[model samples]
Target: MNQNAEYSAVNDAVRGQFLRRTWAMITPYWRSEEKGRAWLLLAALIGLSLFSVAISVWINHWYKDFYNALEKKDTAAFWQLIGYFGAIAAVAILGAVYRLYLTQMLTIRWRAWLTEKHFARWLADKNYYQLEQGGYTDNPDQRISEDLNNFTSNTLGLGLGLLRNIVSLVSFSIILWGVSGSIEVFGFTIPGYMFWCALVYAGIGSWITHLIGRRLIGLSNQQQRFEADLRFSMVRVRENAESIALYNGVPNENQRLSARFGKVWRNFWDIMKVSKRLTFFTAGYEQIAIIFPFIVAAPRYFAGKIELGELMQINSAFGNVQGNFSWFISAYADLASWRATSDRLLSFHQAMSENEQRAPAIDVRPEGERLVVNDLGMDLADGRHLLTDADMTVEPGQRVMLSGRSGSGKSTLLRAMGHLWPAGHGSIRLPAARYLFLPQKPYLPIGTLKAALSYPQADSVYPPERYAQVLETCRLPHLVGRLDEANHWQRMLSPGEQQRLAFARALLFAPQWLYMDEATSAMDEEDEATLYQALIDELPGLSIVSVGHRSSLKRFHGRHVRIEGGRLQEQLVS
Candidate 1:
């Protein structure tokens, strides 16, 4: 294919794919458990839309009688037609109001359902973590929160508008055809001349609109991505404000943020330029359309072949038909936006599906009360060996210290044991009891202190006193009184405090197995020693597998293992 042909072919394929993906995203809600309510609301809204169109048709006919009354100087007939118009307007107003109200109701309900579904899939099987690690999707948070909103609102709005326009086209086409009458052209009589004129006019206008504005779709997609990236950057800075301030990286961050915004700015300029062109053509097209029908039908009225009322009705019907046929031209911008949103949502869904279906190289199962790793081999996603033929077992009530050189995959091994690492081949027999994995930096959700502490668990899971006592045990007694106070605890607390809070969570849950990957790295040696002693004192039988470089951790664990030459080996405790 030539370049243009190739581009057209690619565009067609993309459009087809977009349609399929859009249907896939949309059909679920309509066929879901709430299908009955959804379908009823849709049917009601569509009925209102059709009723509104029917009222427009009635008003079109009323125009004929009202104008004829004015032409004939009949005050009584004019008054009667005005009363008829008032009734029609009332029904039309009610229909339009209810239609909009129902459309919004449906948008919210669909958005709620889709958001819940996305959240469930995202959280299930640690999909969010896998996606982040694999780098398969970007800004999933934005996709779920912002893109879903746009998808729901724009899809419903554009879809319903198209439907209404189609109905209006059909209704008004019949009126225009009947009123237009036959016309002689080159010794041949042509039917529905007005309808044909409207169709041709709208068709030419739409063609030009698409030709000029097709680039907007890709630009809009880029704009959304740029906006999401900028937003995510700002959020990252806020989340890491302390570190950024400590490093004095404000200028660097500002530069990065500005770069992201620059893409948005440039893309928006392209959109504005295209929009300006589209508006220029569409405005002229619409303005000409206003007078074109009147100009076309004037000869019939002047020649006494048609009454003034008929000519007026013909103008109204022609405008409706032309407007309906020009729906694409009018809605092109929203179409581009909706398509971008759909693409983002569909990409997110596909990434999640791919991640969900991925087979793990490491098989983790619950077999016995002891944690066991048999013939485990760890590799990076790109197949770089992290560990090979590593085997170890942690019997019940054993404290195992996992130590290694700075990049020897100690944390990766810890992640593998938790079944969060996917690029490793292994069989891990876990205890049939609760286990908690605390990384070097504990994750404290932004919420009430109780929620942050009991994280991945409800605040109601434990009694109020237990929270206070656990906080006291973890040396976070200051937080006990603030359990009910809502705040961003992660930002409020220092790293040492955060790690201590993680220990408090461990104390509250009292998991049978606890995996700590440098979980106390943020604390001083003395404070770390104290926390380990507290763990030992508070939870007598907690099988602790800790990954740390500190020799100070040796006293807390009974056995020592080190990663050497990409293999696990027993290490002597000094």
Candidate 2:
């Protein structure tokens, strides 16, 4: 990967479109139902932060009195100062503890709100399905699970830290000016010369820190993506463990996994290299800053222009001013990380917004008594036509079976009818009735059998007896007793058993219009025949549109249609 080019692209995006999208993502939460609580928490944190800075200012003055008492060897004055210091310390500690507690409370609340909102959009209007089919985005799972978390915590941390430093900078600059007095340099008398010295020192450090650490923004972004990809590859292996084992594909899987990790390792090495250079500069800069104040103030001290007390105060005040001014230098790494996280979240937000706004090629409406396809056309992502100007309609209570050559459009037609495919221009009007589609491989969510059986619906929607009856009718008597038992049903059951569970689901759901896309392919002819007969006897008025290759399916359907040469041709079903 060309890191420079990628860095440029991400940098350009962050500069141009980052803030608008970021604001859009952030503002909704504050304006949401939790606005009252959010603003209250924010106010408390800000107040506590300012309080902590005030305590620092108080401690700076104490340094003057405490040092003078020591210089005079006044035992009573020194003891009195020590007692005062204890009181100030107690107040400072109390403020610091509450500040941390409140910050955590607000971060979690904000994260939860943003996560729920993103989840809704991801699943809304079938956006998840559309995004997967179009391949318009990658690993939305990670974006939601990881990126939002990083964005929330970093944004709060950086924002509050900056605010605290700004206040500190203003507060300490005044103190440094008054105590350092005046200095004559090259026959020119300079006022607040020490403040100027501290400013220039921090200014140079901040500039150098940015120059060395800017690449980390892009590197961090790439690192996150590479890590997610590696994790996803391993997850795929686990999901398909049986298939991989049957083929003895361990070597190939291992090679693929290793290649993904190679990208992560190389990119992280680049991160370490840049970080090493940055660390060298920052560490040296901080060490020099510690003694730089004393070096600048020493001449006046030796000249008897100021007492030991004022000189010590000058050191304490100068440290605060310089540290506050160098906030950017100290936080450069965190700033880079925050910006990278912001860019990722911004891109994800934009992709979802675009999907929501774009006009789909195939317009599907739900406003009819029968399923209607009018001039329905479908195409591959490459623009190769799958089905062209095909018109078909199924009346209420009709059982129709559609068949075609593999890859000819059998499945695409079903997807278009279901409003999932958008690569082709057409219109499909679905009946205003409950409908369900069973794909070749049924999805059994990892949960209780009753929950999986009642998927897309709560388990409470059906009684216990109804679930048991449906399971028995679908020839899954074994599972009938295990409805309350939870397991990963997809991995635990055989393919044939999973299909049977899908039928049990359909029987439980009882949709008026049913569509099956090779849903029975995993079952034997006898089992498939038994299930079809059960459906016919159980739901006499249920309409089914099935796409399959088995001849046994023909006996259940009163009408047969075949797609040939990108068109639907009617067939006589004996």
How many clashes show up per model? 0, 0
Clashing pairs in 2: none
> What C-alpha lDDT do the candidate models reach, one value each?
0.88, 0.90
Q: Where in model 1 is the C-alpha error above 4 Å?
A: 1-15
Task: Candidate 1: give the clashing pairs.
Answer: none
TM-score of each: 0.96, 0.97
Writing each residue's lDDT as its tens digit, candidate 1 over 1-574 gives: 2323433444564565778777878999988999999999999988888888888888898989999999999999988888888888888888888988999999899999999999999999999998888776778888899999999999888888899899999889988999899889999998999999999999999999999988888788778877888888899999899899999999999999999899889888988999998889989998999999999888888889999899999999998999999999999999988887777677677778888889988999888898889989999867899999878888999999988899899999888877798987878888888888899998888889999999989999999999999888778877778999999888899989999999888888888889899999999998898789988888888899999988888999999999998999998876
- Candidate 1 TM-score, C-alpha based: 0.96
Candidate 2 lands at a TM-score of: 0.97
**Model 2 lDDT, residue 359, Cα:** 90
lDDT of 1 at 322: 94
How does residue 483 of candidate 2 score in lDDT? 88
